[model samples]
Target: MKISSRFTVAVHVLSLISLNKNVVSTSEWIAESVNTNPVVIRRVMGKLKKAGLLDIRRGLGGATLQRNLADITLLDVYKAVEVVEDGELFQMHENPNPNCPVGANIQDVLELILFRAQDAMEVVLKEITMEELVKVLSKKIG
Candidate 1:
């Protein structure tokens, strides 16, 4: 199961911001860290800005964290990506076999399972904060 790229980018960018604080980080630099296009970085950064996690400036300007690192968690970062709706991860099937009892109930069962799983994941994510993420980055980068 692959997570969204936007979530990954947000974590990375926010981790940098958590470490550097008010120092504006360029999209180019973030792109380099992720090894992706700056355009993609900008697009994701825009979403983060809208979520109030970051402040984006134009021109040669860049971005910085808008809130305190201790106040930001992995759950907040992931929520910025979007809510984890039921069956969002599993995806409901439209063409279930009407002839089979199992097929008729698969969608409902899967939906419940997926919802629970997402909730469990969110619980774990909520425990991780930007401060923890920055510490991990520091170990890897410095």
Candidate 2:
């Protein structure tokens, strides 16, 4: 299964806020850009706020970035949105037959490989800051 869309939506929200600093980025406005419901934007914003990545205002005050784009890595957004449980990106099938040799051993052997793969993906994400992504996005928009 693919990672949750929450991660990408969070990235989109932050990018929009950073790029459009002059405008007050309400949930509705961001939702329009993301083509989703305002509730979805609100939910994602709440997670980002809890992670110290965003400062969400009450009522019409709208939201703002708590940290600079350069300071926030893609991994930060990924974790803030909680796309997956910690070290549990790739879940093994439940109730594999313990009586069968391969079934019993499969999870044990595969867990490490999956963890390594997730770690590698995280490393790449950590290296790419939101600033780097917004720069590319800005270039495309222009």
Candidate with maximal lDDT: 2
Candidate 2, residue 65: lDDT: 93
Question: How does residue 40 of candidate 1 score in lDDT?
Answer: 85
What would the per-residue lDDT of candidate 2 be over residues 1-142, giving only the tens digit for each residue?
7899999999999999998999999999999999999999999999999999999889666899999899999999999998898758887899899999999899989998998998999999999999999999999999
TM-score of each: 0.81, 0.91
Estimate candidate 2's alpha-carbon lDDT, on a 0 to 1 scale: 0.94
Worst 10 residues of 1 by lDDT: 82-91
Which residue pairs clash in candidate 1? none
Cα RMSD for candidates in order: 2.6, 1.5
lDDT of 1 by residue, 82-128 (tens): 63443266567698997999998888888788889977888899999
Would you list the C-alpha lDDT of every candidate in the order shown?
A: 0.80, 0.94
